[model samples]
Target: MKKLQILAGLYLLCSSSTWAVEPVVSAANIQEIRLSLDSVWVVLGGILVFFMQAGFALIESGSVRSKNTINVLMKNYMDACLGGLVFWLIGFGLMFGVNQTGWIGTSYFAPNEMDGWHWNLLFFQMMFAATATTIASGAMAERIHFVAYIVSAAVVSGLIYPIFGAWAWGSLFDGEGWLKALGFIDFAGSTVVHSIGGWVALAGIIVLGPRLGRFGRNGQVHYLAGHNLPLVALGGFILWLAWFGFNAASTVKAEVSIGRIALNTHLAACASAVVYMVYTLIRGKAILMRGTINASLGGLVAITAGCATMSPLFAVMSGAFAGILVSILPVLMEKLRLDDVVDAVTVHGFCGAWGTLAAGLFFEGRMFNSEIIAVQILGIMAAFIWGFGVAFIVFKVLDKVLGGLRVSKQHEQRGLDYTEHAELSYPEFQHDVTFETDDMTKRH
Candidate 1:
């Protein structure tokens, strides 16, 4: 009986010991697990955003004439490589470092010693900086000097993008931005990323002037058809897929709300695409492949700011409006004598502004709050002023310093692929074909 009593006592002691230790061990491990999960999600999000570079490259290459295909591809590639390097060295600091009077980041330049979490966030943001820089690559595709474009990309990635980003997103790190303090709600950078990119692209095209024959002496608009519709469609699909990560991962946490965000994104894109096709039909025109693709993208940009906060119905409405904007803005650009190769300004700039306003106008449970709408308008104006104004000045200075931002007439006629890079996307085709000074070649 005494032996039995002793065995029971030992059993209880062992069980009690495990109960005590298990809670302590499990608590520590649960914290670690949460950290690991969050880190993985963030890294995955960065990877998805990085893949967007491929989409940009394919879309831009296909949108340009075959003669300039190689040059466009090269520029997009460098936008990620060279632009990423500059953002890492300087932009990251100016964007996410300690706040300096609610205007800029003051530390973390060329960061090397940040903790793992900070590093992950930096990687994600670096991809965003590269994205903003690449928007101009499409708009400035054919005429821009390769060297000049490279310099501009570095400046934008390292300075303009990050500085504005600091004003709106400084609190992401150790800083606080005035926009955030004013309760501006650009949840996923419709203004900070897309509008900023679009504005810079507008400045670039304005400085570079229209491509030869884009506008006639009598102001007639000429069409510059893309060489490869298949590539354009593929790129659009890829962007659509990657955008799930773009909107959902902005949460930076593994949470239930991601499902809603993803659904909203999908619905908005679909609504915009359908609306674009119908609008084209109503205009007595066949649905254009490029217009449809761009309309979907515009919708995605429009809903990005409000995806988290908007009901799916409102998401659809915002996307439909963006589709209308996509349909009409190209006409306006042509009327204004602007030659935007891929309509980057309309898709990203105007759509981004609309999305920001929608974020407030459609805020769940706080719909049409006047103060919020005003704040959104202020953010939109700030983006245009800083993004377009500074970029215009910088491009003008570069144009003067570099002699000009566009290629020589002869070089432009021969095609940038041959003149700029001594390479050809279609080597089988002869390069001696004469291009008209006032119109694109029949083959194009």
Candidate 2:
């Protein structure tokens, strides 16, 4: 009887101790029911952002002279491929690896925490990184040599972006630093992605200088046109469709607001397209085909900073204004000695800055934290200062080493499609069409 009582007491004590303990998990097990749905949505949305590369490729090829079409396509493809490896090596780790303190990340580059619960969300982020770097290519097209471009693209994807990203998204850095204390919110990277790309474009343009005959000796502007307009329009349409994914996916999870975000994106894009087409009709004799397409893109960039915060009405207004700005800014840039071959700065940088500020002005409080606007502004400055500063230094160094970023003026007149590349974009047309017809048939 004594032994039996002792054993029973011991069992009770052990059972009670075991019951008091609860299992702990490291991160939120978003691997579960509701989060699973959210995961699917985010991953799919990211895929759409990836598809924008095709849109970018089409737009670039169509906007440039025919001889440079294949070259542009090649550059786009290589950016994705090279950018992917760069992301895996250290970029993702730097961006997401550290704790919440916020200055920079400390850990996440490996494959273990890299693959589950997402289509590799890290991988999806990598695609965005690539797109940002690639945007500079079009703006600097027909002038930059291929080897110089490869180095620039690799450096951007590998180092320039990730470091700044850590400041915005790194919990460790943001938590401990000025950025977090100031309540900086960049929900989808208005300045981080678009502005960085714009700054790089600016650097390249400054370093490359004007294309041959782009400016007369008297300082007036000259036209060195594109090869195809229809293709550019088609590319623009594809980008319009894809932006839905870019802005929406930044949520990182499906929530009640995803629907609102999608709506805002669509409305802004629609408003931009209409407003630009109208502006073109009023200004130019016929539709300035490419300008309207670029204007639509500007609206999309402007909306990215606050798709979730602003009303659909504000989105429309924001987009319309951005469209006008994009449609008109290129002439101003030319006047100022900046050569943006595809106007990447206006579409990405200028519109991006405007969109971020719009969030401060128009965000609906009940829908979003009012603090987001201030945060967005801070983010824009951060992106611009860092992006422009770093690129300026890089381009200056490259210019010193490589004798400027542009091909020789002789190469420009001969056509990069035939001279630098030594491959004819249209040998048959060159043989059959008179110079006038060739110029008329071209999209530029």
Candidate 3:
């Protein structure tokens, strides 16, 4: 009887202890857990997107000549550092601040007080601002003065990108964007990010002019092949992996829908790559590695706006069209005497517009709603005007105020790595060669 009583007492004590510690499954508890999970997901996505800076560095460095490799890498590095700082100081507020007018954000500049969710959102968006600024880096590679490039990056991150972003994504906070109010759906910023970058790149290249010797006096185009194709390929793969987070994380939730978004993103990229490869083969041209890599990126950009809303079949269709566009737009750019070193204008600018259109064209169950497409078109036009027109004026002013945007012709012939940075990417290979007075000898 005594043993039985002792055992019963112990069991009751344990039960009472468990009851005391057990979590109550209340709505508040569940909501808190949901918030935590979503915050974590957004942070992870931001980290992935941040890694894209390395991808850009590799791609831009490999695309330029050996002499200019270090210069390209430096620009990409500064873009992340400087661009992130400016976005935090000014851009974030202008993009996500509370406003009644909706033209721009009126608060949140250099935000100091915010909850965990706001911090996570700012971190994620800072990566996007860096990305938009870096797009102009590759297009202006080899010739742009380092100081000028840095200034341009700051302006874009702090002003141009944020203002346009406010007009489209302002509702992310307390303000409502005019475009968003019109039912313009950019699930992941095809126009707001990529197209804006592309437009800035277009403006930059127009002001900088083509690299010397890129076009002969007779108007024949000379191809300046990338020094390291393998690096370009590797960079392409990195960007490909990063894009999943780029598109899916825009949902800002840890939900089942991320699976579908990721699947659509993958399908679009693969379809576009295959289509570009096949097109090259059918045309009897050698399979160009860079073209195919860019084709995949074009598709990724195209699907970003619609990844959340698009079905797999339509994703493929959008990617296929992007492949075609990527194939032809480079040729068109060359014909126009506009020199884009990495074809950033076509891959990001034109393809981003197409992707924005695809979002409306393939909206599930509402395919090709005229009103939605019209809204999308309006958004596209606004991005172009704001992004390109403003950037053009900025670059032109910078060009004159800074003395020149391009390096001296003498410095250009000697390679920017030596003239700009006093460093050489392949110094060991140049021990036997001597730079002549005329600077005519090409540094291999």
For model 2, how does the per-residue alpha-carbon lDDT over 334-425 read when each residue is reduced to its tens digit? 99878787899999988988887787678676334556666767778887888888888887787778876667766565556655454556
Model 2 CA lDDT for position 270 = 79
Estimate, for each residue in 21-40, the C-alpha lDDT of model 1 and write its tens digit: 53446777998899899889
Q: What TM-score against the true fold does each predicted structure earn?
A: 0.93, 0.84, 0.93
Candidate 2 contains a number of clashing pairs equal to 16
Tens digits of per-residue lDDT for model 3, 218-313: 989999887999999999999999998898999999999999999999999998899999998899998888999899999999999999997999
Cα deviation at 382, candidate 3, in Å, is 0.4
Candidate 1 Cα deviation (angstroms), residue 77: 0.6
| TM-score, model 1 to reference | 0.93
Q: RMSDs, each prediction?
A: 4.3, 8.7, 3.8
Winning candidate number (lDDT) = 3
In model 3, what are the clashing residue pairs, if there are any?
none
